[model samples]
Target chain A: MTALLEVSGIEKSFGGIRALNGCSLTVERGMIHGLIGPNGSGKTTLFNVLTGYENPDAGEVRLDGVVITGIGPGKVFRLGIGRTFQLTRVFIRLSVLDNMLIAAQHQHKWLRSALRSPGQGGERAKAMELLDFVGIARLAELEAGALSYGQRKLLELAYLLMADPDVLLLDEPAGGVNPTLINQLADKIKELNSAGKTILVVEHNMEFVMGICGRITVMHQGRALLTDVPAAVRSDPRVLDAYLGGAEDEGLEAEAVRTEGGSK
Target chain B: MAILSAKAKPISKGKAAVVVAAIAVIAVFPLVFTNPAVTEIAIFALMFMATSEAWNGFAGWSGYFSLGHAVFFGVGAYTFAIIANDYKLPAGSGLFLLMPVAGVVAMVAAVLVGAVALRTKRHTFVVITIGVFFIFQLLGYNLSITAGASGLQVPTPYNWNAATFNNPFYYAAAILLGFTVGLYWIIRRSAFGLQLLAIRDDEERAKGLGVPVWRVKLSAFVISSFPVGMAGALFAFLIGQIYPNTVFNPLFDLSWALMTLVGGIGTIAGPLLGGVVLESVQQYLNLYLSNADIYLIVYGVVFLAVMFWMPRGVVPTVGDALRRRRGAGEATIAATNNGGTDSSSEGKATGSLAGVVQEGGK
Candidate 1:
C-alpha cells in the first residue's frame, strides 16, 4: 500500500544553496515520525515543500496516493495537511479564540454567512475545548500577542488542531518552550498519535524525539542519511559522522547518540 | 467548561438604541435647520461619511492602504456624467436610475485595479493605486466626453424651491451614509470580514490557514467601490455639475483615508465620526479663516495630534476605556458574589506567564 504521506525526489534551491537536494522520505499511516538534521540540512525546506509553503524546483509530493506537489500552502491545508511555523505565526492582534475560529472556518458556507450569531455559535465552545486540551484555556480571551512565547506555541498547536487535519507537520514544536511545557507538548503529541493522527515532526531535542517517535529520519546536506528505528539510528556510526562532519559538534552527536541508548 | 459572558457584542442593545435615536434626529434634521448653508454642510458631511466609510471597509480593515481611491470617485462621477450627457437624460429619476450604472463602472474598475494591486507587495500596491489614479485623472483631462477639462453640466432632476433643493440631495447623502455604515456593520460581523482581518494581521499565515487571500481582498475592494461610486453620483447631482479636476481631485481621495484615521481606522462607526468632526471643522475653518491654506495646515496639526494621542483612533480608544471600567465593575460584583474574597484577583493576575517561565526554568 502507498504510504500515508510521501516525499519523492524533491529538489529546492535558494540562490547558491540547495535547501532540499533530491530529498525523499515516506511516512506510514498512524506513525509518529521524527525528522532530524543539523543546521542547513533541509528538513524545514522539505516540510515547506510538502505543506506548499515553498515551491519545489523539481520532483513530486503525494498525500495518500494523490500527487500534490507545489499546489501552494492554502490548498495543502485544505487537503488535510496542517502545519506550524518554526517561529509562531499566531495572529497577535486577534483574541486567542478568534485565532482558532479562523482555522475552523474552512467550510464554504461559514465564510459567506452574513449574520455573526450563526457563524460563531458553536466555534467558541469548541475553541475553548481545544484550549482546555492544550492547557491554555485560561488564556482564551487574551490577545494572542500578549501570551508568552511558550503559550503562543501552544496556541499555534491548538489552532492547527482546530482545523481537524489528518496529517500534522510541526516545525520545532519544542523550540523555545520551557522544559515542563515541552514535556506536556510531547505528551499531547503521543496522545494525539494514539488517537490515530499521523505526525511528522522536525525537532532538535534528541531526548524528546527519541522518547516519543517510533521512527526517526536523519538528514544531512539536504539529503536523508538514514531512516530507522531509534535503537538502530542511535547506534548507526553514519548518523554520528554526519552530525560531526556537518557541524563539527561532537557534543550534539554524543548527546543524540548516547543519551537514550540505555533507557530504550 | 468555564462559560465566559458571551464575548462582548460588537454593539450592545442600549448603544444600538442610542444610535437609532441619533439617526432619527438626523433624518428629520433638515426641517429644524432650514438654513441653506447648514443644509449644504450636512450634504457634504454625509457624502464624505459615505466615501470615508467605503475606504475604511477595504483599506483600513485589510491594512492595504489605498492611495488612489479617487480613481473610483472620479470614474463614478464621470460615468454618471457621460451617460447623462450622451443620452440627453434629464436630471429626473432617470439620472437616479443611472447612478447604479455609475457604481457598476467604478466597481469594474476597482476589480481590474485590485487584481493587479492585490498581487504586488504592500508598498507596490500603494504605488500602483496612485499610478492608476493619476492615469484616470489624465484621461479625464484629455477625454472629449469629459468636456476637455472645462467640465460637464448636469441638469437638476427636479426643480424644487431653493429651500427644498438641498433637501433631496441632503436626504440622498444621508441615506447613502446609512447604507455605507450598514454595509460595514454586516461585513464587520461576517466571516468574510474576519478573513480580511486575518489577511491584515499576517497574510502568509492567513493563506496557510486556507483563507483565499486575494479573493477576500478583491471582494472587499469591490464592496468598497460600489458605495463610493454611488456617492460620486450623488455628489454630481448635489453640485449640479462635474469637472474632471474637481470630481477626481486627490484631496477627496486623501480625505477618505484621513477621516477614517481621525475617527478610528477599523471601527464600524469611525469613518462617519471622523467625517462629521473633521469635515465640520473644515467647513468652520473655511467659513471663518481668511486664508484657505491655513485650514489645511490646521487640519494637518489635528491629524498629527490624533496620530500621537489616539493612534488606535477615537472610537476604539474610548471604547477600550469604557470596557475596562465595565470590566472592573463586573470584577467587583463577582468578588462580592464570591463572599468578598476577590475573584478579580484571578482576572487581574498580571505576570502569570512570567511566573510560569521562572518556575519552569528551575
Candidate 2:
C-alpha cells in the first residue's frame, strides 16, 4: 500500500532547544497508527509540523505523494489532512451545531459561505448527522464550551470528520477521558478505520493504543525508535525501557489500574 | 430541564417588542423633530450606528480589534470628495454611483493592510492597524490629490434646489441605517458569521478544524470596510466638504468603538442600540454643557463602566439574567407539579447550557 502520509527527516528547534530532531515516520492508507512517547519527546511538535502549524527547519511532509512542507495550516487542511489538538479547541460561545457547521463549510468558497445563511441549505442536516454520529445530537444547541471533556473530544472528532479528510491526525484522543469513554473512543476509531479512513493517533494510553491501533511507532528524544505491529512493539525491550524510565510509567500504571478494575 | 415558566417567554417577547418599538420610534424621529439641529444629531446617530456596526463585525465577532477602521471611512470620504470635486463628477449622477468606487478603494486598502497586519495577533495586530491609520492620515494630509490639509469641498448640486440637499441628507442616513441593519441580519445568520465567532473564541482550533482563518478574517475586513466607505461617501456629500483632520478624527473613531462596546460588542443589534442612545446623550450634553467637554468625559466613564459591569454588553447580559430567573421559576413550577421529588437533581442538570439549548430550540 502506498503511504498516505510521509514525513522524512523533519527537524525543528526553538532557539537552543531541539523540539524535533530528524524525526521520520510513514503511515499507509486505512490503518490506525499510534505515536507514543514521554512528554517533551516531540509528539505534539510532530503533529504541528505535519499540519503546517510550524515549519520544520529541515524536512518534507508529503500527503498522497505531494510535498506539503512549509505550507500554512489552512492550506494543509485543504490538502485533505485534518487534526485535533491535545487540549480541545472549540468555539466556546457558539452552539455545538454551529461549531460543526463552520467546519463543514470548508468545502465552499469563503464568499459563497459568507453570503449564505447560517445553518441554511443542506449544512444543518449534515451538521446534525455528524453530531448524532458523535452521540452529541442532544447537545446540538448547547454552547461547545459547556461540554464534558469526553464529549468535547467526540465533538472535535466530529468537527474533523466534517472536512471528510483522507488522513485524520488525532493528538491524544483518550488523554483525559474516562475509561468507559476510552472504550467508546476505541470503538469509534475502529469504526472510522473500517470505513477506510487513515488515522494517525498520538496516544499515551497503552491499552487504548494496544486495543485500537494496528501499528505503533515509538518516539524517543524526538526520533522514532521503532515502528511495528502492536504486539511486537509491546514486547520490544527498548520500548519498555523508554516507558519505565520516562513519564510513560505513570500512564502504564493508569492502564494497569483500569485493567485491574475491569477484571473485578 | 427547567419547567416552562411564563417569565422566560415574556422576557424574550418583550425584548423583541422593545427593539421593534425603538426602530419605529427612530423611523419617525426625523419626521417629528423637524429642527435642523436635532435632525443633524439624528444623522450623527445614524453615522455612529454605521461605523460601530462595521467595527463590531471584525473586532467584536472575529476578535480582530482594528483601530484603523477609520482608514476605510477616511478613504471613502476622500475618494468621493476627490471624484466629485477634482474630477467634477455630476451630482445628478446619484450618490449610488460613487458607492462602488469608494467601496473598492477601501477594500483594496483593507486587503493590503490586512495581508500584513493579520499575520500578527493580539496587541501586535492592534498596533499595526493604528499605525496604518496614522500613515493613511499623514498621506491624506500631504497629498494635494486629497487636497492636503485643506481637503476637498463637495459643492451642492447646482441643478437641484436646497431642499434636495437637506431632504437627501435624511434619506441618505435612512438608506445607510437600512443597509447596516440588513448587513448585520445577513451576517448574524451566515456561515461566515459562525466562522468569525469560531475564530474569535479560538483561532488555532478554528484553523485546525479546516477554517481558512486568514481568509475568513480578510473577507470580514473587506466586507466591513465597504459600509465604512459608503458612510464616508455619504458624509462627504452631506457635509459638502472634508478636511484630513475632520475626516480622520480619532475622537470620532473612539466614539464608534465605545458605542459598539457599550451596545454589546458581538451582537447584531447592540451597536445600533448603543449608537442611538449614546449619540442622543452626547447631543443633550453638548446642549447643556457648552465648553465643559463633559460629554467626552461622560462617554469615557460610561465605556469604562460598561467594560467593568457588562463586558459582554447590555443585550447578552440582560438576556442571560432574565433567562436565569425564568429558568428558576420554571423549575420551581415543574417540581410542584411533579410532587417535588426530582427538584434538586433537575435543577443541577438544568444549568446554563441546558437551559439555553432548551430555550433556543423552542
Q: After superposition, how far is residue B362 of candidate 2 from its true place, in Å?
A: 32
* Best candidate, lDDT: 1
Instruction: Report the C-alpha displacement of residue A76, candidate 1, in angstroms.
Output: 0.8
For candidate 1, write residues A137-230 as lDDT tens digits: 8776666657877888899999888778899989988876777888999999999998888999998788888999989999888888889999
Best by the TM-score measure:
1
**TM-scores of chain B, in order:** 0.87, 0.82
Q: What is the interface RMSD of each candidate, in Å?
A: 7.5, 9.4
Candidate 1's DockQ? 0.38
Error of 2 at A27 (Å): 2.4
- Report the poorest 10 consecutive residues by lDDT, candidate 2 chain A: A255-264
* Candidate 2 collision pairs: A118-B189
lDDT of 2 by residue, B133-228 (tens): 899899999997987988888866767664333555766776777787778756766678778877887788777666788888998888888888
> How well does candidate 1 score on lDDT at residue A26?
93
Q: Which pairs clash in the backbone of model 1?
A: B91-B157, B92-B157
